[model samples]
Target: MSHADLLPADVPVQLIDPDGRVTASADALPSPEALLRAHEALVIGRRINDQAYALVRQGRLAVYPSSHGQEACEVAATLVLEQQDWLFPTYRDTVSIVSRGVDPVEVLVLLKGDWHSGYDPVATKVAPQATPLATQLLHAVGVAHAATLRGEDTVVMAMCGDGATSEGDFHEALNFAAVFKAPVVFFVQNNEFAISVPLARQSVAPSLAHKGVGYGVRGQRVDGNDVAALLSVLGAAVEAARSGEGPQLVEAHTYRMQAHTNADDATRYRTDDDVEAWRSRDPLLRSAAYLTAQGLLTDDRVAEMDEKAEQVAAAMRAGLMADVQPDPQELFQHVYAEPTPQLREQAAFLAEELSREDAV
Candidate 1:
C-alpha cells in the first residue's frame, strides 16, 4: 500500500536477475570450470534439502527447516569463503555447512536428535547450529574480534534469519562488531517470514540492510535467490573485512517456500497463492534457467543429475532405516568427562532397572 510496504527497490549490484539474465560485473568472473563446480554444488545442495524434507515426513528426522529455495544463499556464501574462514550458522544452515566441506551424513546428525552431529568447532571452524535465535551473531563477533586482536586476516561470517534481527542479541552483536571493527559479515537471509511472522511484522525498518547503519556497520541488500549476486556481495564483504575495512551486514532478500519447520504448518497462516508467488522465483529454477540459456545444461545432464540425486537420497533413507538407536545409557556416559557421583548413581540405577527387566 506504500513505498515501504512494497519490496525494497532492487539494486544493480546484483549480477543475476530473476529472468535468468546475467548482468555485467566489474569483478572478474570465476573460470568456466569453477562455475561448473558452483553449479554442481547447487545441485547437491538442493537434493540435500529435498531429502531432508522427505526424511521429516518419514519421521527419520526429528525436525527440519527446509532450505529448498535458499541454495544460492548457501552456495554463494561458501564460494567466497576461504577454508580457514569461520562460519556461524543457524539450524537451516546445513546446506552452507555441507558446502563448507561437512559430510552430508554428519550434517544430518543434529536433525536426528543426536548431539554427536555437532562437529568439532576447532576442527571445522563451523560452530554448531545456534538454535536460540540470533545468538550465533555474538559468537561470530567474538571469534572475529579474537582474530582481529591477533592481527589475523581471517573473516567470520554469521548467518541468521529475518526473525533473529528482532532479538536483543542481534543488536548487541552488531554494536560490538562496529565498536571493535571486527572482521565479521552479518549475513541475514530475509526470507519474508520468520516462522509465521511476516517481515512486515518483524521490523518496521523497511529493509534489514538499513539496520547496519545504526551500528556503524556497512550494509547491502542483495538478491538472495541470485547465486552470482550472493557470490559477488559475499566476496567483497570478506575481502573488505580481511583488509581491515571492518564489518558488513548483508541482507539477502529471498523467500521460504516451505514451512518454518517440519512441525510447522504454513496453511494455518498463509495461503497457497503466497507460496506459489515465491515459487516463480525459486533459486534452483533460476539457476537452472541461467545454465540452460548459456548452453551449460542439457537434457542428458539434467537426467544424470536427477539419477545421482535420487540414488543418494535412497542411500540416505536406507542408512536411516538401519541406524541403531543409541543405547539409553549413552546419555549418562557423555554427560561428564569424569562422571559426577550423582550422575554415576543415576547411570547405575538405569542399568540395574534394565537388567531386572531383562531377567523378568
Candidate 2:
C-alpha cells in the first residue's frame, strides 16, 4: 500500500501566513525578543545561501542547490535541535549543516568536489549531507532505533525534500520508525516544486504532514517561511522525541525561489510572475519586518549585520579559492580498517600520480 493509504483528517496548521500575519499563536511561539536574537543566525544563513549562489555563478561550486527563499526552514531546523541531537541533512541543506556548528568553508568541501562529505560527522553529530534522495531517512531511523534500544536519550532529525517523500526508502524509514516508536523527527521542507514537478502534481493528499498518520505518527504543518512557526513546531517535536515519544513528521510549507540547482532552469516550468509574488513573502524580509516593528532591529543594526554578512561571504570566497590540498590517501583511509587489495592498488596509483606531478 502507498504511504498515504490511511491519511489523517485534514487540518491546516499555520502560525503565520504569507502576509506576515499570525493565523494562530501558541504559548510555545517564539517571542519577539527570541526572534530578534535568532535573526542573526538567520541572516548569516541567508547571506551564505546568496554567497553560495554567487559561487555557482563564478564556477567555484560544481553544483549548489541554493536554499535561497527557504532560509527560515534552514535556520529554525538548526536552532530547534539541542547539541546532543543528531541532524541529518540533504544535499541542499548547507545552511542548516553549517549552522549546526560546522565550519562554513568546510561544508562546501563536498560541493567543491574535494571530498564526499565535508565535515567530521562523528564530531558534528550530523550525518553528511545525503546526496541520494531519502537515504538518510533510513540512516536517521536506524540511529534513533539503536539509541532507543540502548536507552539513550538521543533524538534524530532527518530532513528531506518534497520529492523524497515519494521514495521507497522514505516509506520504509517512516514505517519502521513508527513501529519502533523511535525517538526521531522527520522534517520535510516542502519547498513547493520537487526539482521541476510542482506540489500539485506531486500528491493529491490533503497535506504532506498527513502522511504521518498512515504510519501511526503525529504530524504538523507550518509556514516554512515563518521562522517563529518553524521554531515552535520543531521545538515541540524535538521535545516530544527527546521525552520518548515516537517518530513525528513536520511539513513546512515553503516555496523554492530558485532553480533546483545551478544546473536546472526554474523558468522552464514556472513563470517569473509566480516567483515575483513570493518575493514579497521572502523569509528574511518577513522576519525583518516583524523585528523592526518590535524595535529590536534598528536600521543601524541591520546595516551592521548586512555589512558583516558581506565580510563573511568574502571570507568564504577566499577560503574556497585557497590552495589547501587534501591527502590523496583520504579516499582509502576511512573506507575500511584494512584496505582491500583493489582499494590499495587504487590508492597507490593516486599517490604515484600525485608524486609524479609534484616531481615536475
Candidate 3:
C-alpha cells in the first residue's frame, strides 16, 4: 500500500461532539452494552484520577500524573482489549491498569514507592508501568514478536503520551513492528504536552498518527475525549492487528487538564483559559450525556455508578493508609537466579547493619 493510503484522516474521527451530540453515523459504534460499560468505566476512571490526585496531596503517593481529562482514552482502550491480550502502560496510565482488572491498590504501589511493580506481570499480562518515556513501547513490541514466533494469538497494546512519540525508542519500536508485522497497537494519548513541552514543538507532522506511514503502519486519529469514538476506533485497530494486518498507530487528540504531575505547576506553561476550554469536553461528562440520551444511563444507573466509584476510592484510600514494612532483603532476591559474590556480600552487609541497629 502507498504511504499516503496509510495516513490518518486530515481530521480526527469523532463520533460524538463536546455537547454530547452524535455527529457521525452510529452504525460503527459499539453495542449498547459496550457503550454503557464504557460510560460506567469513564465514571470510575475519573474517580480514580481524583482519588490519586488527592493521595499525592496527602503524601501517600510519591507523585501522580493525573489523566483527568483523558478518561475516554483509558476506558475505551481497556474495554477494547480481550482477556488474552496484553497491555503495556506508561506511568500515566494508572486508570487503564485498574480497568484491566489489576487490584486498584496494587496499581498504585509503584507510585506509593512500595515495590518495583506491585502485581504479578505474568498473571496480569501487564508489564510494570514504565516511568521512562517510550521504553514500554519496545517491550510491547518484543512481546508481540515473541508471541508471533510461538504461534500464539496474542495482541499487545502499548500506551504512551505524545511526548513519548518524540523518543528514539518510539521510532525504533514502530519501525521494528512494521518490518515484522507484529500484532501490536501503539496508542498515543496526545494530551498536547510532554510534561512542559507542547506537541507543536515535538513534531511537524500533521498528526502523530501520520508518523506511522513512514514505517508501513496504518494510522488513525480519534477524538480522545469522545469515548464512543475511541471505542469504535480502538476496537477496529485492535481487531485489525489481531487478524494479521500488522501494527497500527492510533493518535487520540486529548488534553492534559492538570499539571504534568503533582510536582509541576501547570500555570507556568499553560493558562487557566486553556484548561477551562478542555473542561467542557470532559470525557466523563460527554460519555454520561451520550449514554443518557440513549436511555442507557438512567438516574438509578448514575447512582449505582457513583456508589461503585466511591467504594473504589474508599478502598484505595484505606489501602494507602495502611503501613507497609518492606523487607530490605527483597532488593537482592530478584536480581539473579544465583546471587553473584558481590550481591551476596551486599545482602550480608545490609543484614548485619539491620541487626546492629536492632541491638542498639
Candidate 4:
C-alpha cells in the first residue's frame, strides 16, 4: 500500500455523531447483535469506572486511573480479541482487563496494592497491566513475534494512552513489529492528554494514527465515544493483523472525564466547560441511542443492562470493602525459585515475629 493509504482519514471515522444521528455509512458498523453486546459492555464498563473511583475515595485502592469517557475504547479493544489472542494493557486499562473475562476484584489487585498482576496471564492471555508508559508495546511485539515463530495464530493487542506515543519504546515496538510482520495491533486511546500534557504538546503529527506510516504499518482512526464505530474499526484492525497484514495502529479520539487519578486536581489543568462538553458525548449514552434507533435496544433491555451493571458494582464494592490479611512471609516465596539465604532469613524473622504475637 502507498504511504497515503496507511494514513488515517483527515477526520476520524465517526459513524454516529454526538447527537446520536448516523453521520456515516453503516457498511463499517458491526452486526446488530455485536452492537448490542457492545452497548451492554459500555454500561458495565462505566459502572466499573464509577465503582473504582468510589473505592479510591474509600481508601480501598491506592490509586485508580478512571477511563470514564473512554469506555468505548476499552470495551472494543477487549471484544475484538479471540480467546487465544493476547492483550497488553496499561495501568489505566482496568476496565479493559475486567471486560476480558477477569474477575473485577482480581483486576484491582494492582491498584489495591496487594499483588503485581491480579489474574493469571497464561490463563487469561492478558499481560500484567504495565504502569510505565509504552513498555507494554515492546512486550506485545515480542510476544507477537514469538507466536509467529512458533506458528501460533495468536494476535496481540497492545494498548496505550496518547502520551505513550511520545516514548521511544512506542516507535521501537512499531518498527520491530512492522519489520517482522508480527500480528499485533497498537491501539492508542488519544483521550487528548497524557495526564496533564495536552495532545498539542505531545506531537504535532496530523493524528496519532499517522505515526504508523513511518513504520509501514496501516493506520486508522475512530470516534472513541461511539461504541459502534470503535467495535467496527478495532474488529477490522485485529482481523487484518491476524490475516498477515502486519501491525495496525488505531487512534481513538476520546476524552478522560475525571482527574487522572484520585491524587489529581483536574481543575488545575482543565476547565469544567471542557469536562461538561465531553460528558454530553458520553460513550454509554451514544451507544444506547444508536442501539435504540436500531430497535435492538428496548426499554426492557436497557433496564436489564442497568440492573446487571449495578450488581457488578455492588459486588466490586463488597469485595474491596472486605479487609485483606496478607501473609508477610508469602512475599519471599515468589522472589526466587530457590530461596536465597537473605530471603530465607527475612522469612524466618517474620515468621518468628508472628509466632511471638500468637503466643501473646
Residue 171, model 3, lDDT: 97
Pairwise TM-score winner, candidates 2 and 4: 4
> Which residue pairs in candidate 4 collide?
none
Error of 2 at 303 (Å): 3.2
Candidate 1 Cα RMSD after full superposition onto the native fold (Å): 4.2
Per-residue accuracy of model 3 over 1-360 as CA lDDT, tens digit each = 676769899899998898888898778777889988888888889999999999989999999988899989998888899988999999989999999989889999889998678998999999999999999999999999999999999999999999999899999999999999999999999999998999889999989999998899999999999988999999999999999999999999999998899999989899999888888988888888888888888999999999999999999999997998889999999889999999999999999999999999
**Residues 1-360, candidate 4, lDDT per residue (tens digit)?**
787789788888888888788887777677888888888888999999998988988999999999999999999999989999999999899889888989889889788998668789999999998989999999999999999999999999999999999999999999999999999999999998888999999999899999999999999988999888888889999999999989999999999999998999989888999989888899888878877887889989989999999999999999888998887777887788899999988889989999999999
Residue 309 of candidate 2: its Cα lDDT? Answer: 77
Comparison by TM-score, 1 against 2, better one: 2
Range of the 10 consecutive residues with the lowest summed lDDT in candidate 1: 1-10
Tens-place lDDT per residue, model 1, 1-360, is 232422333562567567777776535455555555667778888898888888878888888998888888987788788878999999898889888987666778788888675477778888888889998899999999998788777899999999999999999999999899899999999888889898898788858988887777878888898787777778888998888888888999888888889789899889999888888787777777877888888899888877866766776687664576579888787777899999989999999999999899
On TM-score, the leading prediction is 3
What value does the lDDT take at residue 117 in candidate 3?
A: 89
- The ten-residue window of minimal lDDT in model 3 covers 23-32
Candidate 3 segments whose C-alpha is farther than 4 A from its true place? none
Cα lDDT tens digits for candidate 2, 8-95: 3355456655665666755656877668756777888889988988887887888899999998888888788888789999998998
Backbone clashes, each candidate: 0, 0, 0, 0
Per-candidate TM equals: 0.90, 0.91, 0.98, 0.97
**Candidate 1 Cα deviation (angstroms), residue 115:** 3.2
Q: In what order do the candidates fall by TM-score, top score first?
A: 3, 4, 2, 1
